[model samples]
Target: MKLRFLPLVAVLLAGHATAQEAVFQTKSLTPEAALKAAQAALESCRKQGYQIAVAVTDRTGLLQVLLRDRFAGAHTVTVATDKAWTAASFKTSTLEFGKDTQAGKSMSGIRQVPRVVAAGGGLPIEAGGTLVGAIGISGGPGGEADEACAKAGIKAIADALEL
Candidate 1:
């Protein structure tokens, strides 16, 4: 009986060693920071004479702020949000992801994933080398323009995010 109990005790000890913590910590942008990013992106696009929409998401790919210019198309809302979500989820710029997922590539299948918009204008936000959030822009002339606006948005808040 003692020998049998040894196995049970060993098992319990092993389980304890491998147990995972019930809680953990994560970092993400505050609402004010997110809104600032969105506003900056919008202003950038406006300067370029492009009516647009901007979306900012926290590290978890959850929307934190969204801003649409007065004349931006209705579709821009969803596109901007999806782009931000894609960037946060993939932890990469949507422009690069779009190229990598092009047809004939192994990652091409990722295009089929809902909410994964493999396009430009989506960029991950990093602070202290850790991803803190993402920003996305839509309704510019094309992907490149949209991406430029997104970059401006990040630049606007870079100082605040630096650790």
Candidate 2:
């Protein structure tokens, strides 16, 4: 009887240890959310009389969605995507990153990295203190205007972000 009880307890312990429950989870931006962000950004820029392109990238710098307004510059697409990638990959706004990169010799070499656009149009997307993605805009008269447009994009989805 004792031996049989020991085997049963061991089996129960093994089953508990082998349970496949997840201890941690990660959040990401959905396609619909990305689309909304891009559209809002484009509209915001249009209101300011600027033809613009917007790009949304996931936390790892993967392009999730892109939108370009009519008459937006041909180069704006690549510029927007690179800016979004830079913000998402680095977990910082491109505007602040540019300033930091240019301020010192030690970090200045970061500008040479491929696909790293240190401009003001890129902004990180965060939800519940976790970075979910980034948005970037281009084709505005200046980076400041581009940044404002990008901010509008993020603002459109602020309620759904659970922030």
What does candidate 2's lDDT look like per residue over 51-89, in tens digits? 999999888889999999889999999999999999999
Q: What's the distance in Å from true for residue 98, model 1?
A: 0.3
Q: Cα RMSD for candidate 1?
A: 4.5
In candidate 2 the C-alpha lDDT for residue 20 amounts to: 43
lDDT of 1 by residue, 1-163 (tens): 7898998999998887777455567789999999988998999999989999999999989999999999999999999999999999999999999999999999899899989898899999999989999999999998889999999999999999988
Over 4 Å off, model 1: 1-22
Which ten contiguous residues of candidate 2 have the minimum total lDDT? Answer: 16-25
Candidate 1, TM-score vs. the true structure?
Answer: 0.86
Best by lDDT: 1
